[model samples]
Target: MGIVLNQSLKNTIITYLGFGIGAINTLYLYPVLLGATFYGLTNYITSCANVIMPLFAIGMQNSLVKFYSQYKTIDEKSRFLSFTVLFPLVLIIPMLLISLYFYDEILYFLSKKNEIVKYYVWLIPFIGLCMAYFEIFYAWARVHMHSVFGNFVKEVGLRLFSLLLLIAVNFDWLTVEGFVYATAGLYFLAFLVTMFYAFGIQKPTFQFAMPSNSKEILTYTFYIILSGSVANLLLDGDKIMLNQYMIIDNIAFYSIATFIALVISVPSRAMHQIVYPITAKLMHENKFEELNVLYKKTSINLQVVGGYVMLGIFVNINQLYAMIPKEYSGGLLVVFMIGISKYFDLILGNNNAIIFNTKYYRAVLFLGVLLVAVAIGLNMLFIPLYGIMGCAFATLLSITLYSVAKLLFVVKRLHLYPFTAQTLYSIIITFILFILFYFWEFPFTPVLSIFLKALLITLIYVYINYKFVISTEINEAIDFVLNKIRK
Candidate 1:
């Protein structure tokens, strides 16, 4: 718990810093500098790249974490690490060749509904390749318990690059086209920096020999490819599908709403960096009791933190939209809808790590494929009717079903439940805070209104949580911070 708390705290700070930077890029800078159409185009291209990245890497990032702890000797570990690093080439080389063979046709197909996309179609694979390797290298470092630096590169470094690019474009130093290309280049740069950090942690000799578990490793990677694709698809498929059914700028509108909602999830994402490998280690050792304890604790801790963020967003949503450009304000409902699904994700803490690391993962992969179909079908059906809000509806429905199914599967298969009475308490408290504060309006400006409401909400929420002790872990965390402040 010491190392977990230490790294998780650092990562939470880094993730929020990244999100803060992203908020600037998304809400104000991009709209002011790039305009809605180009902003949407940028987000759409990156989303497409994300949807393809899991396939390009072919699940080696997860495979490395799942298998790294199983190797007993340095030689075996080195061999396994080398294989995972090189394994993605199996798909990358062939995929690149295939794309080249039918490049124009592919672009033509993708840009049919949004022709602007054809102009930047080539950046998709470039960014996808970069993103895939970044995760692989990040995982490389995570297996060595060096996730904070990798998290910084992933979270802060890339967004900082975007800020620089935005400034360049704002100054007439580069065209919008150049800005888009520079974004891809930044992803590649981040990947290289992460690779350097990973190798600095443990430089591999690139052992050519395969580990004895090659067969098992390859099999798990194959299934995880489908699982990974499904997960990423549900996440970004809405934006991609929005391109097909609606205009390009609608993607930007939807992106802003989703970004706001995604803040509810930063805690889980940050904690997962270190907790995932630990969960994998515990499962590898068959330590169910300790694993169970970690699982329950993570769920409550995430809910306590994530619920607070959700309350803040929902409470001050009106003020937030009031500050942003009017055009981007249409997706307020999208924020609430997506935020709920993400909260469910938090409540199911480390569920993905548990599933992906264990033998039961195959069942979840099949479930994920079915959910992917449902998500795409829902998006195709709903976006035409509801527009950007429809995309959020489809995502919320698909992700909720997926999450509930995973929760049930984990309970049945491993008998490890992440929910408790305190989980219910957190949910109720979240709604109480939302109802009390969300509708309350201040006579002040949006910024001041947000501060006043958020501060009040935080005070009430924190006092109740500490008084009733919603989560002992959270209580301890608060005490630690208070003690540090006193010191």
Candidate 2:
């Protein structure tokens, strides 16, 4: 438990470091320089690539993590690793070829406005291949417990490069076309860096002789692809559908709203990276007691950490929106809706990592697919009437359903519960903080007000959690800080 908590903390620090860079790139610079429509185009392009990558990936990336520990000899593991890279290439080549053939009709249906749709034709493949391989190598690194480097590449490396490119555009050093090209190029570079790092750890050699377990791996990959596709639909499908049914600028607005809300997932993201492989190992060893402990601690720890972020965002939403133009300010409702949705996910703890890496992943994913379909249907019906807000409501409803379904599955199957008195106490504390800070007026510039409010809310949240001992995990964290000060 202590080791897992320590790893989770380290992962959170690096993850947030990446997100700190992303927060600036996504929330501020991209919107300021690119404007909403162009920003939407960038977000849309990335989202499309993400959705497509997992499809063509043929699930080898996931198979990499699950199978790595099973191989006794390094030679055996190397063969599995080689297949991880090759299988995806074989699958992705045909998928890309088919996509290129149908590019025009696909673009026509995906875009309501023709202006940016043309870019998608070529961009999709570049983005898809870059994203797919990024995950492939990232999975390799993760199984080795070297997840932080790949995370830095993902969280900080790409955004930092994009920030520079956006600055270049602002000074008229590059055109939007150049910036888009640069953005797409950065993703490939990030993937390359990840691959290089992965190779440093374990240089995979392509060998022809099939492993006796090749058929077993292929079967697992097939199920995982279905699972991955449904997961992407839940996460990325909203932006894709919004782009299809509405204008590009609308996606920009939705992108910003979603970006703001997505912050709540940062803690979970960091924790999950380390937790996934560990949980997989535990399950493989039939260590259900250890897994149960992990599930509860992660849920509590994530809730405590993510709850503070949600409180900060909700309390200071008005001031935060003031940082952006008024055109983007109307996204506050979207922010709240999505923020709440992420909050629900946070409370579910590592329910996702637990379920996705376990034997019962397919069943949980099927339930997720059902909810995702509802989200699509709702967004299709309502986005025309309500625009980004419709998208927000659809996302909120769908995410809530998805999170609840995940929680239920974990509980019923594992006989585990993440909720406790501490969970209720955290909720009460967040609500109280929200009410108190909700009405308080800090007379400062919008930018300054956000900083001041965030600081105060963070301090109060920690103090309250410490005072109440919200969870043993956070209490121990506080104690560690205090002990260092005393020493």
Candidate 3:
């Protein structure tokens, strides 16, 4: 927990910093500078890329994390690392060739509804390939317990560059189309930087041979591909669906609301970087007792922190929407729906790591695939009736159902659960805070009002959690920060 805490805190700070920049870009600059249509197009390109990224990488990122700790000899580890690096190319090359062969068909399918997407259709695979390799290398770093630097590059570096690019657009240095192309270049740059950093951490021996456990490795990688696709589909499939069913500008609105809601997941995202490899190590060693302890601790800890984030956002959602454009304000319901779903995911803690590392992962992945279908079906059914709000409803329901299924599967199969008494207490605290803050606001401008309200909420939330000691780990963390401040 000590290493997990140290690295998780750093990753959390880096992630929030990135999200802050993303908020500025998504909520203000993109809308203000590029206008809603191009803003939506920009998001649409990235969302489509993310949805296809797993197929390109063929699951090497997850395979690295799950298998890296199992090898005892450096030669064996080197062989495995080399395999992870090289294996994805087998699928990537063929996929690119296929895309080239079917280029016109692909463009027609993507642009049938929206012609603006036709010009940018090529960027999806290019960017997805970059994203895929970046994760493969980023996973390379995580397996060695060197996640902070990769995380900094991932969370802070890309968003910071995006901020600069938007400013470039503002200064008339780059046209909007150029901004889109340059963003794709940024993805490539991120991949290159991470690849070099990963090599710096463990200079790749670049063996031509496969790992000794090639059969097991290949099988796991196959399942991971499905799992990764399912996960990404859950995250970004709605946006792609929106591109299909609605106008491109609506996606910009959905993007804004979703971005605000996504801040709740930052703690889970941060903790997963460190906790995932540790969970893999524990599973490899058959350390079920330690694994169980970790399961409970991560659950309660993330719940406390994620609850705070969700609370802050939900309570102050009005002010947040106020700061954005009026047309985008209709996404208020999207925020509530998506925010709750993200909070539900956060409380599951390392539930994903536990499932992914276990043998039952195949069954869980099958369930995930089914839920992806369900999600798409739901979106198709709802989008015509409602709008962006309908997409949000579909996302919320699909994610919640998926989350509950994962939770139940872990409990039924492993006999481990992520909840304790603290889970209930944390929920109660969150509920109370929401009721108290949701209906009131300081009579000031949105920025100042948000600051004062967030400050009040933070102080009160921290005090109650500290007093009740909802999580001993959280309490110790608070005390540690306070002691450092006193010195």
Residue-by-residue lDDT tens digits, candidate 2, 1-487: 3666777787788777777787788778888888877788888888888877777778888888777888898778878888788777777778778877898787777664646767555887798888889999999999998888887788778877887898898899988777877788998898899999999998778776556588878877877887787777778889988877777888887787788888888999888877888887887898888888777888888999999988888888888788877788778899899899889888887676677667787787777778878999999988888988888898888888888888888889878788888888989899999999988868999888888888888888898898888888888887887899999
Across 1-487, the per-residue lDDT of candidate 3 in tens digits comes to 3999999999999999999888888888999999998999999999999989999999999999999988999999999999998989999999899999999998988888889999999999999999999999999999989999889988899999999999999999999989999999999999999999999999998999978899999999999999999999999999999988888999999999999999999999999999999999999999999999999999999999999999999988999888888999999999999999999999998999999999999999999999999999999999989989899999999999999999999999999978989899999999999999999999999999999999999999999999999999989998898899999
* lDDT assessment of candidate 1: 0.91
Q: By TM-score, how accurate is candidate 2? A: 0.96
Candidate lDDT values, in order: 0.91, 0.82, 0.94
- Each prediction's TM-score against the native? 0.98, 0.96, 0.99
RMSD (Cα, Å) of candidate 1? 1.0
Candidate achieving the largest TM-score: 3
Error of 1 at 158 (Å): 0.8
* Superposed Cα deviation of residue 410, candidate 2 (Å): 1.7
How many clashes in each structure? 0, 1, 0
Better of 2 and 3 by lDDT: 3
The residue ranges of model 2 lying beyond 4 angstroms of the native Cα positions read 1-3
